[model samples]
Target: MNKQAPQNSVRLPERMRHLAVDSRGYPVIATINRSPEKVDFGSISERRKLALGTFDWCAVCGMPFADELRWQMVFEEGALPAALSGEAPVHEVCALYAAQVCPFLFSPRSRLSDEGRKGEVRESVVRFVGFESTSAVIPHASELQPGIHTLAFEQRGHADEFSYSSPDELGERFADALAREKPLPVSDAEAVLVRLFNRLDDEGEGDVVTGAALAAGAVFAKDIFKVQGLGAFQGKSYPTAAALLLKGTEEQILKFSHDSQDEAFSAIGPWVLERAGRFPLALQRWRTRGNSMVKNLGPSSPQGPGRSVAKNAPCPCGSKRKARRCHPAGVQATP
Candidate 1:
């Protein structure tokens, strides 16, 4: 009888083991070293060069950084698939922080009564505390670093000293950061940028008018705040992107949302539209200014409004014909 071969696992790359498979069955070839193929995510160029789903990919948050960052699973208590047993999966990073703060988010809180939920003051209070505590601990958090808190929270495990921050805390931090940064209203921002570009242009700065800037300006005009583009018309002038920041019920901004209760929609959507409107306005202004500037130059050779042709007269340039025949296309002969 012939001896049968084992079919199950296969060896992968440098020192890393892998199971090989075929139509019949997968078999292990042998354990091998993990591949020496090193990848870097820091460089955007490198990230672009990478193929999709090449490295550790997260379904929820997308790719996790190779170096220090780790992925953690976060799921609502009841959200776990029936097939899954204990807890919903999450990245390790999220798991660590979730472990520290807002433990309720990980496993569902089943105890709260309907009346308690209706009140739900405790949850809000806890979140507020979390935000204040985090801000107190982390200067950067209090400062409201843009995406830094998220980034830091993601990479906290890598560092020696790091604190857990709740999502609310993160939001507050971001808001504070925005406050500190004091981003000009979207309309004002574009104007500032445009002004900067002009100053740079006057002083022989680098290419200020760029495809990206134009695209960005167009997006600002259409989406966020209505700031006119570098060259735009006045008929198109509209409000600043700040209109999107209007914090009120849809009832308040009647012109904004289709529904009165749609608060989120009312807040940001109009701002985007405002920005979009501005792009055309800016372009129109540019054209108008350009025309005026061009007109400032001296006039060209003067000429009559084609008054030379006389009624009943032969054409001056002789086509050797009567006035009627030669200059039929020209002015009628004088009576």
Candidate 2:
């Protein structure tokens, strides 16, 4: 008998990056970005693409990850060796910025950029923050390209983040792992969170959402989008929040707070064709459009839009004879 695939299909690859491994090679460090389309860490040369190395600058702040600092990862089950390279390594502050305002950060199953597949009701996402283990080392690579691409590392003891109850606690322990590392001050972290929250609020400016609700969402996105994929909006959780943020569904949330994100996706239809999903359908629709270029260029126009037969035809205005016979020569004779 042949072996079967697991009960739940892996919709997204488990991208385990070793960007945080130290120079001495003790622990391995890594993190996962939610959607593959959102994964743009590898656009530069290997030297500039510091996220691929064991030590690199923070993607957001452009500072080093520091000696023995703990970082966060959101992941699911996959072979450890096959863990793919992930997004650019970011500062905890920057990651904190992203965690807020991102609906998909909270819900691992949520598709951040792909609105067509926002909450498809599959794929379990687990979140954790941890430090590199002491066993991490540089892995052999045949061709080292830049930014963030998947590579293999031989690090052990990183999965310990799972044992902890909260990522914050793990971060503290990660601080302990650093040589002479002072744990990131809680006040600093709190300050970062507050700054990120203000930014989210600023982003929601002209939307239909209420001011109070929007502010609440800023906190919720900061606190919750990283953990659960949803924060409260119109009495709903992950799905509603995702719909509002990604699909611009403020009205939809008020109309159907009880429905799931999958239902909303199905209902949104052609509005999403160009934005996400079924590109063939969008192309086919374009090809078969009622008033197309061919229709516009010819004289047999059902609607008055395109360029119809011009200067040479007999005037439809009923002077009857062809343009050359009737009036102006070589001018685009009126039909």
Report every candidate's CA lDDT: 0.25, 0.30
Worst 10 residues of 1 by lDDT: 130-139
Highest TM-score model number: 2
Q: What is the TM-score of each candidate against the true structure?
A: 0.16, 0.26
**Model 1 per-residue lDDT tens digits across residues 155-185:** 1122221222333334343333334332123
Residue 57, model 2: lDDT of 33
Tell me how far the alpha carbon of residue 21 in candidate 2 is from the true structure, in angstroms, after superposition. Answer: 28
Compared with the true structure, model 1 gives a TM-score of 0.16
Candidate 1 lDDT score at position 221:
27
Per residue, candidate 2 scores C-alpha lDDT tens digits across 212-291 of: 22221221222222212222232544333433423333444333333433322222222222223322221223223312
Q: Clashes in each model (backbone N, CA, C under 3 Å)? A: 63, 19
